[model samples]
Target: MISTQLLFGQLLLGLINGSFYALMSLGLAVIFGMINVVNFAHGAQYMLGAFAAWLLLHYAGIGFWPALILVPALVGLIGMAIERTMLKRLYKVDHLYGLLLTFGLALIIEGGFTHVYGSSGQQYPVPAALAGGWNLGFMFLPIYRAFVVAASLMLCLGTWLVIEKTRLGAYLRAATENPALVQAFGVNVPVLMMLTYGGGVALAGLAGVLAAPIYQVNPLMGSNLVIIVFAVVVIGGLGSIMGAIVSGYVLGLCEGFAKVFYPEASNIVVFVIMAIVLLVRPSGLFGKGD
Candidate 1:
């Protein structure tokens, strides 16, 4: 029998991990929804964000707060560059080719980082403002984790608003349905496409920054998490923003519970759930059949 205190603590941890999973998976869904690219390099891009933050703090004497803003901007700009120079060329090709290209890019990035940084992890300190915990009746919750949950949730809501409520959102939705038709209406679909991709990647970068304090900063960090995120996305639904967010958190909580009840199955629990979901609804809970 699980104690209420332990259950509550695990729920909090689950929500914390869910924030990252949801943020990353939502970004992936947005990118895939617009461009139909697999974006295999997303994990590498996320890792780059952490590395950027680490660099700014260590070499440039920049603080975490500044790096939090600057790193995502820098990484977003890099993503835009990649989309224009490399991704654009593959637009007319088979999606498999695009996936292959991104996979290769992921390899290149991981290899480059491994060459320079070696495989060992680096630490990032929690900012002074967030370096404490709130004591509840039965447990203490780290302030940074709470901050991460709040910030990530806000960003996710903001992204949803941008895609669903605003004029830009209208254009994006229209463009996704029929790029040629939207382009005929005097909108520059290509530019919007590039920006969307960059923004999605930038979100991943932001997740990395948020994660740096909790997890060791390393090349493998993003790659490892990305798989679980992919599973989350799959279980949620491809290209469904709301679904991605909901599924990420739900699955994260489930994983946390599994850890407490059947520790041995925790590792495979997510994948097992994904397989079951796939068997039941191949298009996923919120996905439209392609």
Candidate 2:
């Protein structure tokens, strides 16, 4: 029998990993819902977020707390610029074009960072305030990991509420359904698109910032993780906000269990689940099929 400590500890680790999966996949879902674009560059933007935090620390003497707020904003602004300048041009074309464009952009960003930073991983220290752990009798829980889980849950829930309940969310939904009609109703559909894309990119950046302390701040960090996030999105359903959130955590826990029982299979467990889900429900667990 697995000890309670081992079980709980792995589950905690899974939850931490799931937090990032949920955030990144949520951003993917939002962008796809609003723009019908697969943002392959999302991972690179996540890398940028970590690097942004690193730069602020080394150059400007900024700390983690401030970087948490500023990095996302800066990355969102960059996302807005990219959407306005490059991605907007591909809207009328085939969706494949957008995918290719973003994929190319990802390669460019990763390559550029590699040229500058090499392929090495940089370390980001945990905040002094959250450097400790709690002994819960069954297992010890790191405060930083707990913080990540709590913060991610709040962020995901807040995003869900904004998209599902708010007036701006109503407008976004209306625009998605009929941009022409929404524009006819005096809504600036173009600007809405820009904001939506920026918002999605910002979520990725936020995830990157949260991740910097746990993982090495490396250029390929996002590249390695993004594929799993995409799988999580697919398993949850594309364009599904809640689906992304749920599937991320579920699959993360599943992976964690696999790690305990069958360590060799842990890495492939998520993909295996993805394959099973596709076979059972191609549209995803929470996705609405067309």
Candidate 3:
């Protein structure tokens, strides 16, 4: 029988990983839902955020606290620029064009960083304030890890609230359905599109910043996680925010239990679930029929 401590430990770790999945997949959902853009470069944007935090700390003496805010804003600007210059034009064309462009951008961004950074992972120290752990009777939990879970969950819920409850969100959904109609109403749909893409990219950057202290800061780190995040997005539904958030955490728990019962299958369990879900509902668990 598995020890309770070990079981809880893995569950905690899985929950941590799920935090990342929720953040990254939610960003994908926002971009896709708002503008119908695939944004394959999201992983690259995530890598950029981690790298930005590292660079700020190294060359500028800026720390995690400041980088937490500055990095997202900086990366979001880059995303907006890409949207204005490239993605905007592709909106009228088939979505394949946008996907190909973003895929190419991802390759270029990842390649550029690898060439410069030598493909080796660099360690990012956890902030001094959150550098320790708490020992519960059942399991030991790192303070930084706990902070990650709290912060990520708050951001996820906040994003959902802003997108689902606010007037701006309604405008966004309307633009998604009929941009020309919204534009005819004097909504400046182009600007909204730009901002929506920027917001999505900003969220990915924030996830990267949160991940820096836990994982190595590396060029390919984003690519490593992005595939699984994509799977999470698909399992949740193409553009369902709540779906992304819920599926990420649930799958994480599933992975945790799988490890105890069937260690060898833990790695493949998520994909297996994804396949089964797809077979049952091609549009995904929370997706709507057209």
- Please list the residue runs of candidate 2 whose C-alpha ends up more than 4 Å from where it truly belongs after superposition: none
Shift of residue 20 alpha carbon in model 3, Å:
0.2
- Cα error, residue 219 of model 3, in Å, equals 0.7
lDDT of 1: 0.90
**Top of the candidates by lDDT:** 2
* Candidate 3 overall lDDT versus native: 0.93
Off by over 4 Å in 3: none
- lDDT: the better of candidates 1 and 3: 3
lDDT of each: 0.90, 0.94, 0.93
Q: Which candidate do you rate higher for TM-score, 1 or 2? A: 2
Q: What C-alpha RMSD separates each model from the true structure?
A: 1.1, 0.9, 1.0
**Please, what is the TM-score per model?**
0.97, 0.98, 0.98
Q: Write the per-residue lDDT of candidate 3 for residues 25-87, one digit (tens) a residue.
A: 999999999999998999999999999999999999999999999999999999999999999
Tens digits of per-residue lDDT, candidate 1, 99-203, equal: 888889989998999999999999999999999999997888999999999999899999988988999989988998899999999999999999999999999
At residue 180, what lDDT does model 1 achieve? 94
Tell me model 2's lDDT, rounded to 2 decimals. 0.94
Model 2 Cα shift for residue 265 (angstroms): 1.2
Candidate 1 ranges beyond 4 A from true positions: none
